[model samples]
Target chain A: MTSTSTAAVHALAALPQPYLLFLGDTTEAGFAKTAIGLHDWAPEVCVAEWSLPGCPISTGLPTMTPAQARAAGARAMVIGVANGGGVISATWLPALVEALEQGLDLVSGMHQQLGDIPELAAAAERSGRQLINVRVPPRGIPVGNGRKRSGKRVLTVGTDCALGKKYTALALARGLRGIGVDADFRASGQTGILIAGSGIPMDAVVADFSAGAAELLSPDAAEDHWDVIEGQGSLFHPAYAGVSLGLLHGSQPDVFVVCHQPGRQHVLGYPDYPLPSIEDVIDLTVRLGRRTNPAIRCVGVSLNTHGMTEQDAQAACAEISARLGLPTADPMRQDGRFNRLLEACIA
Target chain B: MTSTSTAAVHALAALPQPYLLFLGDTTEAGFAKTAIGLHDWAPEVCVAEWSLPGCPISTGLPTMTPAQARAAGARAMVIGVANGGGVISATWLPALVEALEQGLDLVSGMHQQLGDIPELAAAAERSGRQLINVRVPPRGIPVGNGRKRSGKRVLTVGTDCALGKKYTALALARGLRGIGVDADFRASGQTGILIAGSGIPMDAVVADFSAGAAELLSPDAAEDHWDVIEGQGSLFHPAYAGVSLGLLHGSQPDVFVVCHQPGRQHVLGYPDYPLPSIEDVIDLTVRLGRRTNPAIRCVGVSLNTHGMTEQDAQAACAEISARLGLPTADPMRQDGRFNRLLEACIA
Candidate 1:
């Protein structure tokens, strides 16, 4: 047994890959982002998609059940839909149990353990298959010591949770390397961890060590090297500001990009709490962030403009850039949209 | 085993008592704050103190070994010393094992587990005494929903960890009740939990659920009733700011008291990281706090002037009160000093 004083970061990297993605009955594309993310970022390891009948969402991967996917070289079935509060639905149990029985290890990012369900546990035990909870942080993560590290970091913070922080950071890292800069994408959540083959599941870590874990996520490196760290919950997100604050302080980003969903009004799941403005996010990020990183600055703004017209998305980005005096881009735009942001970050 | 999605708050309240306090071999009084706090606040439960040879600290209770304490009717031995970062010393293990062997249940607030050590676990098992870890939060705590509860809450925030957050909250709650006010002291750490007979172990909570657990701590009280919540960790502290921010947002305190140690230059564990100014702390607390409670305001300052001369402490309080335009008082001062602070909280 390991010392309880330390925590281990067991990543999805060790899970037998070539995965069959379980999308549950989620019809919304947003709920299927994890499966889509894997298809987009780690396509080679994603064998196919599995969803219940009537589920209209798709990652464009071939539809296959657990038995078919396992026969097609899939060794683990990943629960790709992030049900709200990470609570597993009982209806999703049959597919999960089937995956285990079919000789595919059942993996989940849910806070509610997949093995805790009697049927799933029984199936796994009988089949000798594994049940992995990526959201359960391993023991013994030390408390963060607010020491300045040598390497530079850029974190993608947001006005709320899940608005493109992961996508923006992924794009920025890829874009940085494209421009001959030394950069690495640092994932902070389940989907990102699965995509990157490694990362700290920030939301699952013990609260006291959030910063410490972040410190470990992007350790000391060449002064010129950049760790493009993906951010989690927003500074104004009432339910998650604490997690956001800890990540902010721990990441100590030399540069930050604010991620926002233009039409999103209230914090996700918290209808009573309205989302903070981008300006407010920037102001508070700098105000509290100065405790750990006095030189931290916002290099750009990243908007998730998936539902908007091209003209409207461009207008929003242009208007925000003028108002906030920072470069703005929709990370999905493949043109030179991030050039200004890249320049500012490297500067 | 419990559902992993939710967390439980098991307080030190049920530990078999009147107790024997274990002081370890700590030389500093600050390190012995737990033992002293129990002796000071929960005197009825604390019958004696135990420390190894050469330990200079004292809780002013009669010294007793575990055997002697058990003979004197003590049913539990409490680890009352907060060793830096709660790392237990190997030298203290023998005394702990002795306590378990001498017909006493062993309890610890340290992040390190007593049962994890073979000697103590064997002793407890052989003797049929329990090994209780108040630091281990129970299963099935939901994520914070950021819901507004019906209650007037006051939180004692800090400039760093291990100052006066717990004591100040205790005093304010006691003083509020003395003035015919409906109030309760809500503990957030182990010693505070022991003192109050219940609390959420903020440090042990999963990072994502810190705020959610805290919401459960204060709960919904009468609109006029006050939940004087004990704070943990400073927002400026490197190792524990996440815990602090989570508690702050969860408590949603309408009024907060800033607690500081007059001469503390650095964060408790990290000497390289300096403690934040009271002004800086107040600014950030209110700024971040506004997200949870729009009318959040600072009511007063709680200073730990234990190492200061009476004249120095008085002068410091006067200077700070005038500078910040907030009432200031040393919690140890019983000259009706907290009256002004209490009035401001209710105001």
Candidate 2:
């Protein structure tokens, strides 16, 4: 009774590929942060999306059945929504169970551990499936002492929580590597942890030990290698500023990139709290960073212009660049403007 | 085979109190911050000290034995030193074992979990003695949202790390109660946790949740009760400033008392990092706190004039008070000058 169209099955045959069926159905499909991240990063590994039965509209990816997903060599069914409080919806349980029955692995970056759910865990266990929960921090992370080390440490800080700090850091790291630079990406959050293979989920760490996690991640790189540390939270976020400051102090970055989503008028969680101006965030970052490292500087801006026209993105980037007297770019846009940021970071 | 001094036993009997064998032999005696804290707060609970075998020149308390300590009604063996990185020394194992065997409870505010030690834990288990690890955080602490709460929260911040913020807050609380005001002391560190019997070891908490622990500890206090929130590390401590900021943000106090130890030459752990001026610390606290609550204010000064001449203490307090236009007092000196500070806080 499940829909596995022949056209969808044939589409799987053209490439020797194993992809992910990002389950962003109903509420998750319309506005999911994790799904949006996967949309950008998953194409390299995934070929299709899988929505709930009643919700067919995905974020423009071709929808697929578990059989077609298997035909296309699907490896895992990713719970791709940035679910509020990270609790998995009861609505999605049927699809998740079905996917496990189809011998697919389960992966989630939710705050609520998928491994902790008895049904999904038992299903994964019985079917010999791997349920990789990415939000759990690895143990024995040493407390950060904020000791300054050699080589430039570049961190991407944001104006608000979930404003694409990880995306900016990764993209900047990739862009740097493309230009024959030895820049290593240091992941500091869940999604970044999943993509990068190694990172500390900053939010998951205890407060006093939070900085230590940052210190461990950016251990002494080679003199030529720049460790691009992914930032967490924001200095202005009422709920998360402590973690934000902890990461800022822990990394002891010499240069920082202020990442901002162009259209965010209010803080994501607290509507009453207004987002600080880009200038305010940049000034705050420099002032706080300089408290430990006097030489620290804000070198560029990583503007997340998602869902914007190319002309709008260009104008926003240019306007910010002009106002701040710093290079600004949407790293994912690949409009060649990101080169300016790369040059600024190195310079 | 162990030595128990008769004279020490007589001294303890006269006091009719609990004595602590401050294990400050070896490295702990020279510069143990916790021992220093206990020295200031110990007269409230303890009357004697017990040093290691070779550590004869103790911190001025009459040395006693397990038999002598028991005769004197010693209830617990307090680990007096702030051991480097909060590690319990191997040298103290025999002493701890001896104390445990003598039907005494083991008390430590160390970062190292005493419950994790197989030998010590097993010894405690066999003896049915309690091992009070003061630094263990209560589970399931939520992230602090920095939501404004009712009640007058007065936090005692410091110009540098370990400058007697706890002593100041406790003294202020006492002074407040002495005047018939309803005041509660909220301890935020290990030593304070021991003294107050309730608090979060703020430094041990994971970075993101650090603020949450602070939030939980100083919840909506009674309208008539002034929650005297004890502050932690200094804003200038290079290694611990993130925690300092976290505690600051988490408390979101309406008013703060700035604590300073006269003539502290350098930042505690870092000789290269000079301590910021009292004005600088006050300004920093206001700036940081104002980011969350615009009405936050620096109300007074808690100057620690320990080891100072009475005349010098008065002069120092007067000079700081005059220059800053704020009431400043050496809370421990009990010079009754704290009345001015009390007036400022309540005002």
Candidate 3:
């Protein structure tokens, strides 16, 4: 996702909760992931959901209008839809302006700044509300220097985008903490930022400073602490490998987990190329990851078998583990199936 | 180099030529590559050079002030110094504002926008002159798709930054044209953009669009035509590797030339990380490059031996060529030494 914000994420982190989620008029469940993620992960901060007519998807939160949300104590309205191109839709502007008019701050993670639109800017000014763009990175990010930092890191890498990298990282970080390990799940995408309340949107950063931003995201900590970084695009992805490589170099993860989806045939949008083999991903990750951290290795494989039956998922995980000689599990599997992956990471 | 521009490169390509070169007060020859490059490669468009007093370097062009250069038929003043941080120095503001007041359009390739400075903006407006920041990328860049374009491409990959990747690409493209071949030099950095007239500042593009920009830089062409692409950053670089990898995948070169400086032991600005062996670069580049172009190969090696004597340089090239069993030459050497490397590329 493209994000461009000059606003500090500290302000974003404290966005007056609970929020009114705005789902733009997109029927694609993929585009409404923000609302679903917030509802699933940060329910405490979500008051209700709002969408234009015929959007056909919901976060299952109570439906409300801007005025009703204001009365319901939502201090802010979060744009809960990620446009395919990271743009603010002209059709959705009327609803956004109403949210600002109703005494609520407007928050977005799109690359386009909200203040650039005259109507939104005027309404925000008239209502004395803030327009927060969390995607814009703060200035003065240094170029990455390749200096090693203290603390261990575990980055979740994938063969493609939206293939369980973020979910695996979140599960790993939470599981690490559950096992008495000091850990933090570092977010790198817009939806992850909204859920965690702070993150550097890696894809939106200037090309020159992406690695630097990754370094800033997970700074120095205790030697035993772990920063489980939410990965962006895969190392093999044609469009986003730059962000992926920069983050890999800067995070300097001592170990990483390879996250993949079974039964996928090609990169998300590019049909000319087929998906790379899991072995190829592992080989490239290790060779390239060695640049920043020589000890880097793949600790496990996290499969996203959302489409498969329980029996098929178990068989796939076992086959992959035996083939790669690494721990394997579906972190999102309903029956606490992340135990082996978590153990491999800490081991 | 970092550049952000909303203006189209078509406008930048037609920047009023017959220019005055502005050499900011820097004793470092490296930072003055912009002036040196334009003076050497595009001298017909250069009228004179200007530098703050006490600066130790010169492009050997006659010295002149903004007014004097304007009187000499210079239509624009090019900021000929590249700041290491891609920032505009406050100390250089007076000279820049004076250029605008003197009726010469001011042009810069710095990441900081020229119109963002109040004094420069006011002076340009009052004088009816334009302030051009070529570093800024125009909006609407798409994500890379890794589709094969109908052209043969030769990209100059480097072992480290500032190791003659641009020079090698420029020389190779020129040589190809000399032999009755259809070839175009594609620039991906500020200096190269200034020289080539129209090209993307790859380092300045948003991380998400950089690969897409690269794909745009070398689009479909005649089957036998060659696009000699100037690369940015090294795969070993901590900060800019993302830009490098994206460009590599997008360029999808059929053959690549590895450029290196003979004695450099570490990355230019990063002192802690040792440079990877040339063999390692080839191995990783081919392994990763095959994802986009399965036929990719390292054609030759280009060394920057400006610091060495002719005899020493020849010895170094010969030694490396013998060691790797690949053709090696100093493309910038006297007496047409790039012949072997050039032959390798097209053969």
Candidate 4:
């Protein structure tokens, strides 16, 4: 028995690339951002997406079952959707339990703490698997003092709620890394937390410590490194604007990128609150950010053109660039421009 | 034993007015704000003070031992000072234990949770006495949405840290109440929590929840009533400005009172950061506040004149009123003027 376990451990260690099972079960419509972004990024470690039978595949990635995933040398199951209300569906529990039983770690950013659940935790313990909750923020985070830190920070803010702030931040991190720039992704919400392995659910945190969480996530990184902090909600969303301001103050970023979904008309719940013009957003961001950091500046605009025609997306990007006098692009398609703009701003 | 317990209960119930034993052991300079404020407020309910041997009596009230306190109809013990470091001193545990044994309810606003101490919990449980931790903020507080609520909110903001923001707020609440206005005191810190009977320690709450606490503390006050929300920290203090901003946004006050300690040189810890002029503070508060409520205004000034001569205090108040074209007063001394100013502003 000992020899068999040792051989299995050796086999797992010998695998050169770690495989991930992207769990996007029931991912459709409003909950598919994480899956779609992951599919677009095409991280080399991710092997295949998983979903329940009859569920629409939003990411268009290859599919696999828990057994198939384990057989393919998958080490972890990554939750790739912010499901409605952040609750893990009962259909996913069997898969999560089976994966744990097969020694595959369970990774999630759901507000419903997976590790705190009894059956999944017991299964993981029995199989020596780990449960990682990305949205569990660091404890005892101090209230942000707004003191200057050592490293450069690049925050991705947005024109409206869920307009690809996390995607822009992640893409920027990747582009900077491609250019040999030492950069790290600082996740600010649930989906970003799963993608980056750790983050604070800014909305879940107590109001006073919203900025404190942002500060803790992107603390004094080394002088040569860049901390790309993910943005949450938006300044226009009345329900979540307080969070946006707290994060802006806490991060104290020297430079920022504004993310927007072109042609979006109004904030989600309150139709009366129309989306601000691109220039208005830029001005508001700078004005709000500089209250805490006087030297703050906007370097670029990240456009989320997922449902738009290529021609329309290009037109929108051009218009934003011309009006705001800032470099603008779809970060996933034109990641290098975003990186270059950030480089210029920080330099 | 049953007869003796019954008689004791009757004796306690029959007392015309309950007495309070004020605890201020080890009280010294830099740790007497609570005692001093409480002394000045001079609540008729409190009967005597308790302090360690050789410690100066900052409140100038009568003194008593734990046993003597109970004999004098003291039904509760109030912690009367914000001790250094917020930790409960070991020297006071004996006194606390004796008081609990004597069946006196314990009230404190210290960060070191009184109920969490095993000995104190056991004693209180055994004697059927209550332990109140006033700074324990409400749980599951959602992020402030900056939505309009019924009634008027008047927040007290300051030019720098520890400038009597809480004292001014409490005094304003009292003055408004004295004029038969339905006004409530909302506490934002430990000392204020102790005085008001409940409040969130703004600094201890997570960043996102700071404003939420403010919102929760003064929720849906009646149309005829005014909620005087206590402010925390200062807009210019680097160490805690985020909290101040969060509270300001959360309260969504229709008007504000700018609290200043005239002639103060700088922010408490960072000497290089000088205190802003009164005009600068008022402008900053209004500008920051209006982001949430566009019609928000600063209608008055509350000055802390602790060390100033009476003539100097009057001159300072007069200068502020003349410069800002607003009512101004040392809330403790010129109580009626403060009340009238608040009435006029809300009216």
- Per DockQ, the best of the predicted structures is 3
Clashes of each: 13, 8, 10, 15
Stretch of 10 with least lDDT, candidate 4 chain B? B7-16
**Off by more than 4 A, model 1:** A1-32, A47-58, A62-77, A81-107, A112-132, B1-33, B47-77, B81-106, B114-131
- Docking class for candidate 2: acceptable
Q: How far is candidate 1 from the true structure (C-alpha RMSD, Å)?
A: 4.6
lDDT of 3 by residue, A202-249 (tens): 888889998998998889999999999999898888888999999999
Residue lDDT tens for model 1, A198-253: 67889878888899988888889999999999999988877677788889999999
Q: On a 0 to 100 scale, what is the lDDT of residue A151 in model 3?
A: 94
Local lDDT at B210 for model 2? 72
- Across A45-64, the per-residue lDDT of candidate 4 in tens digits comes to 66777876676764665777
Native interface contact recovery, model 1: 0.76
Compared with the true structure, all predictions reach lDDT values of 0.84, 0.74, 0.85, 0.71
lDDT of 1 at A328: 91
Worst 10 residues of 2 chain B by lDDT: B1-10
| Residue-level lDDT tens digits of model 4 in B1-347 | 21112222211022122335455555464576666665566466566778777776556767877677788887878776666588777778887888779767777667777777778878887888777655555456666655677888899998888888888888888888877888887777767665555566776666556666667767776787788988887766655666777788778888888888888897776565678777877887776677567888888898988889988988988888898898998886765567657676567
Q: By TM-score, how accurate is candidate 4?
A: 0.84
Query: Could you list the CA RMSD of all candidates, in the order they appear?
Result: 4.6, 8.9, 3.5, 6.8
Task: Kindly state the fnat score of candidate 4.
Answer: 0.32
Looking at chain B only, the TM-scores across the models are 0.84, 0.81, 0.89, 0.85
Q: For candidate 2, what TM-score does chain B get against the true chain B?
A: 0.81
lDDT per residue, candidate 2, B53-101, as tens digits?
Answer: 7764456667787657877778877777764577888878888888778
Better of 2 and 4 by lDDT: 2
TM-score of each: 0.85, 0.77, 0.91, 0.84
- Ten-residue stretch with the least lDDT total in model 3 chain A: A1-10
